[model samples]
Target: MAVNQTQSSLVIPDNNASVSGNPGPWTEPTFTLAAKVRVGVTCCFFLIASCSNVAVLCSISGKRCKSHLRVLILSLSVADLLVTFLVMPLDSLWNVMVQWYAGELSCKVLNFGKLFAMYSAALVLVVISLDRHWAILYPLSFTSAGQRNRIMLWTAWITSLLLASPQLFLFRLRTAPGVNFTQCATHGSFTQHWQETAYNMFTFCTLFVTPLVVMIVCYTRILWEIGKQMKHKNELARSKNDLISKARLKTLKMTLVIVASFMVCWTPYYLLGLWYWFQPEMINQTPEYLNHSLFLFGLLHTCTDPLVYGLYTPSFKEDLRSWIRRISSILSRRAKNSKQLAISELNIKDLTSMEGPTSTAVTMQSVF
Candidate 1:
């Protein structure tokens, strides 16, 4: 999902890790500008995304943050956080070293994590959109925030893990006859050709296309519902008031922003993958820079959730501000206390100095 060779739609390293082994002359991979840029971008994103996703997790896990949308966001942030921590650093390493020195087990685990996080994030988005669709269009049927069952969240994680389990088997450290180091990759063979193609199609449709379709449909229906409700003069006051609530509108906007960011960040990687599936030759022809750039774009989505939600949702914004203020207060208090202690110490020193030998002698004599 990020920039891992295993996650790439091409399933083939554009240059370094050859699919069919050593074709003829084998030369060591040299570091290039694309590698440098990919490493730098990945490192930057790893820091930003890891911190933001963690902050979102902290913000939403609080008692005050109870809501269906917040719960969904909590789940989504978990997935993004996993991607940021588990997938990003290794992907960045692969981008730079252009070799997989890690053993077969490491390869399987890393690839599984990448696929699991990606699928889980996408599926969670679909679930959120569906929840919104149900809540917005049929207010009567939707459960209250406290009443919402966590079954769907559990199901998303389990389902994503089940779907991505193939990576454990398909991924292994592969080394060409003449190559010194092994790379984590699937075998590009006649037997495995169909398997790779089918898996790629499944991942693309499940993780990208289907979720996108679900989001679009849900959002469209939601808008239609809102518009229809607004037009009905005889609509129940409660319904009208619900629609007009600032919190509701903010939630909707936040949802749209999250969906839009996901689409923007992921679409290119999926589209490029789709193209590569049809035109395997293009894999060789596609510029390495473009491939790295697309992966970077996809990775950017991992960091954007908090920003999107914070900007559009007042509650999250307020929570963030409160968290910041609390931290500032603690720091300020510590500084003030330290300053007071310093002043007290200085005053004590001045008093002792002023007392001089006379005071010291009197005090010692009295004590004796």
Candidate 2:
């Protein structure tokens, strides 16, 4: 029998290209160009907004502002910033330009970073929603702080790392058959097909669907509590305006914004992915439109995270204002001090002149 080189386990064919030994079906170039432009712009927006949020959060000091929620917000902001700065930009560049300029190592790093940030963000949002729900529903029972919250945060980090590990193994950069450019994708082989399927299912369910359900339930209960509180006609204005009640209202509003932003940012991507999962044939038939649409939807998450930060975090705004005010005060004080020194020097010179010959001779001798 002839040597069966094609049947070897070490060799794998790129399924992304056409069967005629060509690179691709070569869909409309316009779609790819538009998708690239959109992703690039969105990534830039994400980077700017997330970096601003991180700066704002870092400026906050003192004890009153350092709650569990604040800490969680900071973590989320860091995660968002990482995704914006590290993952989305690279991914956008690759997809939009239709080339992976980065090497294999970068592809792996991007895959890991993207999955890590995404899962961490999703988990934190769920935790925030639950924290708000508990604070609203059972205020006395959920007094976690300091060590407890730290422990929980550590746990979240570990969980996120574990959840995102699979992506590192599953994704790789590979040259498409007969093509010069490499693309990032799951390793497609007979042995890895089932693994990819399982990975996709797990990622979709845990990172998107499950947390989304939990958020919906938690927010619904929170809204119900707020409505109940609002309807109490006999409730004293003093109690309504109490610090705890006001804080609760603020928490509710923040939670609403978080959930809304999460849904708005991720829903399109989830829907697009679901369509692809259920109908893989669409990839070959309408690769340009479907892929571009999916890419655009995915970019939305990176862009909307900063909006969530701005809407939800009052302390972020306060800290920004405080920094501006502090700088202004410092500048003002320095200017005043300089003016006072100038006035004092002028007065001293006038006094020296008034003291006549003795002081004038002494001043002239010191100057010489």
Candidate 3:
């Protein structure tokens, strides 16, 4: 999710604030070349994330039985799709416009939508990690996995909604004095600076810190369970245990890679946000380009999720390949048809030209 740190660069400094004087004649952000590049990059990531996640949805939906794995994949894809459709385009458009043109109502709703999508993306992965932990550690749990998965899905979505709801109350259209630039931010939401910082700290904890800890803990337990099983196996089962250990380790390694990438992508932005919330002066101290770069780097996580998950998932990878071939064939046929149609038009024009000459020759012969 985007933080106020991003808007700090765009926001005009308050004369009443305790920061450096005037930062001199505040200049509002414009549709600069950097903004244009951001829009283009965001668009590219949006398209990639949209297609991959949609493919994941379609592939899972087409299956005859909805296993827990498929269900988890569907949930992850849905979460990514939410980010692809909601966050990427909105952020890009906001950058291009350099201000919130939509009304205050739209601002509140979009802000809510953004945070909701962000929560869903992170929380669903937490759900998946928990599911994996349960399946591996307690294979014969009291509750059926299907039932448990449904419950977790409901909880993830409901929790995301509840957490993001505050955005509706916190964000509004704020216009600078004597300027037409109005932006959607939490500028006037809190009376005290500490209150605003407190709210941001709460969001940061819920959105990033808690989910991350849950996922890492879940996987850590899973890996321990795996190693324990290997250690306790009988000598007679050593050969089979080796195979199982190798396979499990390979899968878990990939899972850890996903967690690592998630951290790498989001950690910088969140850390920067944490710093800015405490040290408001750093808002001016941080470069605008650095903020943009980190925000986009965070957005890259949305694009990476599907690719990583799909590439490793045999079924999803096959579905993606089949889809690529299908799209390629369709385009090929359309292009071939267009070429043929053009040839026919050229031939018709040539015949029409010849018709005039032939008519003139016939007329001259008749005259003779």
Candidate 4:
């Protein structure tokens, strides 16, 4: 979901220069600064970790790496990275130091990036859940990996572009009356309202609610499948242990991890949005403290994405281990070389002592 910076009920004045209409108080600068700093640091950490994992996963070139789910995971990483690198940094800066100081171009770019990333990520998650559900419930009838991957890729691109169209078309920079800086927001008009409503409904339904329902249902069915497998194993006396069974177990674990993380990360943001939707006037009447609190909670999703990848991807852990080993090896070699050089100097001093005619002679030779 796109983050809304303005209070819901606060209306902008019609005249650019007049401050006649009293719309509620603006958010406090200090509180906003703290919120931005906290969010920025969190997003930076997630971005670094997630991008590192993505690089590692993409570098793998074997049969195990060529799964449909892995492709979806990569797509998710890219989408989250885009949000972290392209959108959140500028958003934090705008929130803390310069409320929309970067100008019209920045405003447009940030808006588009935020909405596009969010929509794409949501779409990928939904696709992943559906794929898992089909594979587990109807193994024989499941779609080919190539077909699913192609369709999801197309959907991600098209949905993101479509979702972001509103920002590109409706967003503009307008001077807030009596305020020195310009604000980037939806233009206030009937057309803008209908357009934003349509965008919100699309996002709320397709991106948030639909995916959430699908994940819950899919995971529930998966649990049922696992139960059936376990029961069959218990009852059968001559069942063969098979490679397929092992692979299925591994896939189930990974799916559980992904679904759990996605739900935990995204639930707060969607709940907050729903809350705001139900109580439109709360934004205007609520104190800055409450609004800022909601904003921070909403941003937690961006901060938790990398942790999700690390929890699910075995390749990510292996790559991290390899990185640590390389660093350790480098340090060990440097230390060994330093020790060898120190021993060589000592040996040279010992030889000079043995060849000296007197102690003073030996000390002088060593000094030279």
Candidate 5:
């Protein structure tokens, strides 16, 4: 029940950098008045996001469930974790420095990884939504572990990579006339205008719009099925079937919340990106601060997913708490040992000082 999927549309292609082909003497207002503070805040959120998602992965690893839902949950957690590790730090650095210091290949790889993570997260959630739809509607015919389900998971990754492949080719280092430093930009040509537009449209539809529609439809069907099942609930006693019904309802609600969170977090960024796609001049008119704000909002989804997991999944909470306690215990023991070591050394020094030159034998056991 460790359901998690947070896809950010902010890391799409960074067209803002690309759009500035011919530079002028323009002042880019750093998003927040205190740019350092904003950078610190973003970095803190990314760190929290990284830690929480890694904890989710640890929790998942501690369990052994062969259910297809479990597999999907693992996939989603891994995708989100990758976003935290691979994308968030670079995002923070870019926000603060406002330049691509890591060079061309890194820029391409960074963009590719970000897009890959976003697409994979979206695809996994869509598949999970569909899986739940089938499970609820065709209970008798449904099984979590199937060869088809494995194929579907594989296809999801393959398709995400294919969709994200453009990032690897399109993004590279570029320089504007006035800028001294290079920036990571998607190179756009006059002939590739339609191609760029088409690709952006495809990414938006496939990663955000289509997934939202599918999840909404699937959850709608799931709700209808749950309502129908409830009508027959009185005929059966409080048994396994009843428990399953309750569990299904709980899961449906959890998934709805997760989906809602994803929508709220990414919609602004994606919508703004789409607007930028068609009306490139609008970018020049838009406040520099607003773009960063939208990107930060979308970035928040990475941290929010782990919180959603803790709220919805009791088992995940327990496992995560257990892992935290284990880490705390290890730290505690190390601290204690260090303390004892210091005390023992001090006692030995005290004994040597007290008992004069030949006092090598000290009661270290007593000190301990």
Candidate 6:
């Protein structure tokens, strides 16, 4: 969440440009060092998020009966895919182009997509935290966990779409008065300065604050529950439910890690956005590369979620190993086949050369 939610967050509001007698041309976006850095870093994140999230989906997808945990993780993976496929690519392309070239329709659609992707990821994490909270506090009450989780996941996705739908209306192609530069932003859409600020703040609350509070509360209670469980460890050690209790605790720890990564990765970027909202002048004071870096840093959360998931998932690791071995086996067979073919070709060449010499000698003798 940047000062401007859409338009690549590159178009900082300038109140005086139209007020001036001679409005200068908008300085075009260049593929400078800042952009180069964004491209490189975002590409790395894209690959990581894409591969890791897809792997998570695949590893859990084949299970006949998914627990609420798996369902929430699957939903999270899908949300990460949205960020990986939509936000990362769009940001890279928009930065490289430096302006809106994909026309007004594309501008609206892509802006909507960016917001939707972000909202989905944040909301899914909220769902995951809430699910864990419910499971920990009321294990017996989770009679239909799958059905309940499905409903929550649906609600999260629909809410994400609804929250992000305004971007289509709020953003459009805004061209400079005398310049050919057009940006996908909310410049003309908002009549007053405060309206844009209100919108940004609203987005900030939805994208960061609300979700943060929910997760913090959920995880805090979970920690308290863990502490209580530790107090009864000796009793649980003698009970038949000991193994089940330990497994649940391990899963809770893993989910907390995923939540922690999301918070750690995005906290700084959103905090910067909050500061910029209060002090609009920071946009100018801040170096270009710093802005780019901060946004890319926030994107790191998308990659980290999958890494956390994969780390906790033993089945995913086993599947990965199997995949690696299968690929290596296929490569080795191809290499061996190629070597054999080369040897056979060499033998054919030798036979052809020897036949040529023998035929030449026979012709010479006939001529004599």
Global lDDT scores for all candidate models? 0.73, 0.62, 0.77, 0.62, 0.70, 0.79
Work out the TM-score per prediction.
Answer: 0.82, 0.73, 0.86, 0.75, 0.84, 0.90
Candidate 2 residue pairs in clash (backbone atoms < 3 Å): none
Ranking by lDDT: 6, 3, 1, 5, 2, 4
Instruction: Kindly provide the TM-score of model 6 when superposed on the true structure, using C-alpha atoms.
Output: 0.90
Candidate 1 C-alpha error for residue 315, in Å: 3.0
- Ten contiguous residues minimizing lDDT sum, candidate 3: 14-23
Q: Which candidate is the best by lDDT?
A: 6
lDDT of 4 by residue, 1-368 (tens): 32544322122322111222335545423434546555566566556655664654554433455467667666666766666665556555555554456778877777777777767777776777777777777766544865877697788779778867667765678665565646676645234434445666666787678878887888898889878878888653544435655665576676567667667766765676655554444444555455545554544555555565566667767767887898999999999999998887787678677776566566657656
Better of 1 and 2 by lDDT: 1
Runs off by more than 4 Å, candidate 1? 1-27, 144-149, 188-192, 233-240, 243-246, 332-368
Return the TM-score for candidate 2, rounded to 2 decimals. 0.73
Per-residue CA lDDT of candidate 1, range 266-364, in tens?
Answer: 888778877776555576677878877888898899888878866765666788789899999999999999999788667655756889866766655
**TM-score for candidate 1:** 0.82
Worst 10 residues of 1 by lDDT: 1-10
Compared with the true structure, what per-residue lDDT tens digits does model 6 show for residues 136-226? 8888767877888889999999999999999889878777666777788776786665676788899999988999999999999988987
Q: What C-alpha root-mean-square deviation, in Å, does candidate 6 show against the real structure? A: 4.9
Model 5 vs. true fold: TM: 0.84
Give the runs in model 2 whose Cα sits over 4 Å from its true position. Answer: 1-31, 61-66, 145-148, 189-195, 231-237, 284-315, 322-368
Q: Kindly report which residue stretches of model 6 are placed more than 4 angstroms away from their true locations once superposed.
A: 1-9, 12-26, 64-66, 234-237, 356-368
Instruction: For model 3, name the residue pairs that clash.
Output: none
Point out the higher-scoring one by TM-score: 3 or 5: 3
Predicted candidate 3: what Cα RMSD to the true structure?
5.2
